[model samples]
Target: MVSSIAQFQIKPIGAELHLFGIDISFNNSALFMIIATILVSAFLTQSVKSSYTIPNRIQSLAEMTYEFTTKIVSENVGIEGMAYFPLIFSLFMFILAGNLLGILPYAYTFTSQIIVTFAISIAIFLGITVIAIIKHGTKFFRFFLPSGTPVYMAPLLIPIEILSYLSRPISLSVRLFANMVAGHTMMKVFGGFVISLGAAGFVPLLFLVALTAFEVLVAVLQAYVFTIITCIYLSDALYLH
Candidate 1:
């Protein structure tokens, strides 16, 4: 049986190439990311290509997802948030697709990598910060300290608030990375048991099946959690208090 951790390794697919000083060789993680992007693109685009008065399965699913994302943005960030709906929707679908695709046989789960999740989280964090700065100017810094506090409390409260704000990317990244890694690792361990036990593996096989369904739910839930938190951050940026 293949080692469970071996599945997460980033082995180059072909000739490894160096661009300047960076290692730019294509690998499994990159390949799976591309696949996820293509799949999401096709699903979103094709689902609405031929809109019928009474939507078909694909169209219905697409419309439902669109409406769901709209509601999320509206509730979390208000009507003005609709301007950012495309970004929010794309982020949700891409992460969801990546999580779901990783469940397939021999598929790589890039989201399991802390570096990958951290990178995405950092980008979102930076973008939100920029938006806040642009919209509120110097007042954006006030987010680190709540209003109505005493002047004497500034010394203690500012540092704590600053630390909390800086930890956003780390917390967001770790949450997704931890969940994906834990769920996938457990499934892999159980899968190994199923293989080794042969005929007696029926028990573990059943568990693996249930675990898989749970993972799927997790995949969707994590996507929602990540997106909603982003919306909340966006709301904070748009309206400081």
Candidate 2:
């Protein structure tokens, strides 16, 4: 049987200067993130530089991405949430590229790693917390209090709210990490069956092909879900609730 758990092999590319007692070893995940960043930057710059009034292919792609993200933010958070377009759009592109790139044979899947997803989720958590505090000031604490709750229940409800708020990062990170890892593992398992069964494996092989297509759709959909959730969080922060 094929192993569903991927090996977390830590290959040391190089070690940076140690900070205090901590040594930082760069690895494949770092490399893929750098590549993803460069790809996103290049694509955006090229698309914008070749701008056309009537919209060419690259321009249309860029516009479509913008409109897609704008619609999500607008519908979920309303017009006042438009200020978050850049962050939402960047998140969507980076994640979409990372997920899609990982679909390629032998490419590293960064999103499958907990560290990467945790970093992203934590950043979103912090950004929302800061925005809430800044926009609502000390009144942000009121997010915990239910509108119709009895004044006596405030003590009980506030802690629950605090717990829920604190759990956002955990929930966000796990959702993406679990989905990416599970789908890829399933794909790998089915793919192995095709190889092992040889010519007689045509049925399983056909199913594997279909699953590949589904995984591709999932890659895009998960990216969208992550981005839209981010917008919703931002909206909650900005509008308080």
User: Which runs of model 1 end up more than 4 angstroms from their true locations?
Assistant: none
Each prediction's number of clashing residue pairs = 0, 0
lDDT of 2 by residue, 1-241 (tens): 6564553344556767467878766777777888999988887778777445678788788778888988998998888887877888889999998888788876778898988899999999998899899999988988889678899989888899999989999998888888889888888887778778998888888898898888899889999999888887888888886
**Each candidate's lDDT (Cα)?**
0.91, 0.84
lDDT of 1 by residue, 160-197 (tens): 99898889999998998899999999998999999999
Candidate 2: lDDT of 182? 86
lDDT of residue 139 for candidate 1: 95
- Candidate number with greatest lDDT: 1
Would you estimate the TM-scores of all the predictions?
0.96, 0.90
TM-score of 1: 0.96
Task: Provide the lDDT at 56 for model 2.
Answer: 77
Which candidate gets the maximum TM-score versus the true structure?
1
